[model samples]
Target: MFVDTSKEVRDPNVSAIAALDEPTRRRLYDHVVRRPSPVSRDEAAAALGLARQTAAFHLDRLADESLLDVVFERRSGRSGPGAGRPAKLYRRSTKQVAVNLPDRRYELAGRLLAQAVEESDATGAPVREVLHRKAQELGTHLGEQNKTEVFDLLERYGFEPRCEGDAIVLANCPFHALAREHTETVCGMNLHLLRGVLNGLDEAGLEARLAPSPGRCCVRLQPAA
Candidate 1:
């Protein structure tokens, strides 16, 4: 079956809070999301009930961040064909931000875990160790089609892995710490699935280490087993 989700052009605005206070940042995100097309600095400001000058200042800053690109330059004002200048139009970028959300933290953790370990095998070490041996387990799991499937599965679980030294390391897993706070039941399970995900892959060929704490659950890669 096929479904058509009407295409929506994305707002190329990333959260640039350095110059803007939190409130203004939120307003900017909202403005870009709701705006039909690239809006003039003045229009954006008016939408947020801010002054034109202030809006221009922030808009330019957004452009610097690659979050916005100028689509057209125009001069809008009262006058004639000989008007002083025209305003610029900025179209939203085609990039959109999608957030992963879970209805129940525990359940969400389970789904994440289940997805992470789809390609795990236990050859050495604790053949079926869960929680304690997540990275180890996931190392071995590969797909019948190709290793790419295994790698992709990890990505689906939001595990961005990169090769380092002798092993594959998880670049980022946003759920790592959050799962700990949300509930302990699945945090352990998460580790378990992670292990299963790595299972079967040569242990000695790849080493996975929970990066130094205070990090967002990045598994450092190296030779294992």
Candidate 2:
């Protein structure tokens, strides 16, 4: 999913990826990641034949984007007054960043599926039933966590919600590929998920239902009668 980092609305993973698009910055990142230990400004500069000022600027930028982590330590084994100030070092960040076009959340799906399988195996329950329950639980949690309007929440998750009459149609399905391949299973999960979302949001006005259409999500939100 792409979160416009400039707006600071969500995770900055996309911005972190964009930072590496610069030639020099990408090279500096590559160099730092390959090292056995954190690299200092001087070491990185000398290795890349870049000026110290230029190397410092890019390294700090990488750290700022959270692509790299910053650490300070004394290179010399001295302590007290003579030891001098700690040297700033750069290393690859522990944070993980993944971006998908059209906003596929396969990892989220995988987690739900895995939880369902594990729970079913332990409880001797049906896997499909467990999957739907898990999906709904997650959706409820998402709705409760995000206090925004329904349309904004859907857009944040890449549902691409659109208005049609008194109902909301999703123009893009976040689980497009998976739902296409496993129609019944995925669509059912999606329906329950949105239902739980509405429930958590205390949205008594809208009810989520299955109304599959081409080029749209399987679930549609319609006004409750």
> Which ten residues in a row are the worst by lDDT in model 1?
1-10
Please report how far candidate 1 places residue 34 from its true position, in Å.
Answer: 2.1
C-alpha lDDT values of all predictions: 0.51, 0.91
Best TM-score goes to which candidate?
2
lDDT of each residue in 92-143, candidate 2, tens digit only: 9999888887888788888999999999999999999999999999988888
lDDT of 1 by residue, 1-225 (tens): 111223443322324333334567547656875777668877888878998887777677666655567765555546767766756766554544333432123345555455445523433333224433543343334322224434555554556655555456665554655655654534444455555554543233443445534434434545665
What TM-score against the true fold does each predicted structure earn? 0.36, 0.91
Q: List the residue pairs that clash in candidate 2.
A: none
Residue 195 in model 1: lDDT: 54
Off by over 4 Å in 1: 1-21, 75-86, 98-225
